[model samples]
Target: DTFTEDQICQVQEIHVGKPRIVATIVPKGSPFKKMMIYG
Candidate 1:
């Protein structure tokens, strides 16, 4: 997926402050997507 420059920059900035902000995918199709935070 292509993200805008600003969006990418924002994500980078967020990573600088908190380097663990990524989504965790679970097995099978579900309605809930888990978000794992590890700083």
Candidate 2:
């Protein structure tokens, strides 16, 4: 995966009502500045 273990953990913590949605985490200027999650 593009995300690290900690980054993955951060994504897992997020909760939403929709089954399919996009998630963007981390700050700008970093390698993983933008992340897209869809499942």
Candidate 3:
């Protein structure tokens, strides 16, 4: 899904001291779907 750049609220490292990412985000409109994400 394509989301407007303005829709982006925030982007940052999930862990403060770690450099590994196990999950990523897939933007969504619905609150429920929005909760789900993948890289």
Query: How accurate locally, in lDDT, is each candidate?
Result: 0.56, 0.62, 0.58
Q: Model 2 Cα displacement at 18 (Å)? A: 7.4
- Show where candidate 2 strays beyond 4 Å: 12-39
The model with the greatest lDDT is 2
- Write the residue-wise lDDT of candidate 1 on 1-39 in tens digits: 899998877774343464666666666554443332322
Which candidate, 1 or 3, would have the higher lDDT against the true structure? 3
lDDT-better candidate, 1 vs 2? 2
> For model 2, how does the per-residue alpha-carbon lDDT over 1-39 read when each residue is reduced to its tens digit?
497987877774566566887666667676565333222
Query: TM-score for all predictions?
Result: 0.28, 0.26, 0.20
Superposed by TM-score, candidate 1 places the C-alpha of residue 8 at a distance from the truth, in angstroms, of 0.4
Assess candidate 1 and give its TM-score to the true structure: 0.28
lDDT of 3 by residue, 1-39 (tens): 976776655644355685777765545576656456431
Error of 1 at 17 (Å): 17
The reply for model 3, stretches above 4 Å from the true place, is 10-39
Q: Rate residue 17 of model 2 by lDDT.
A: 67
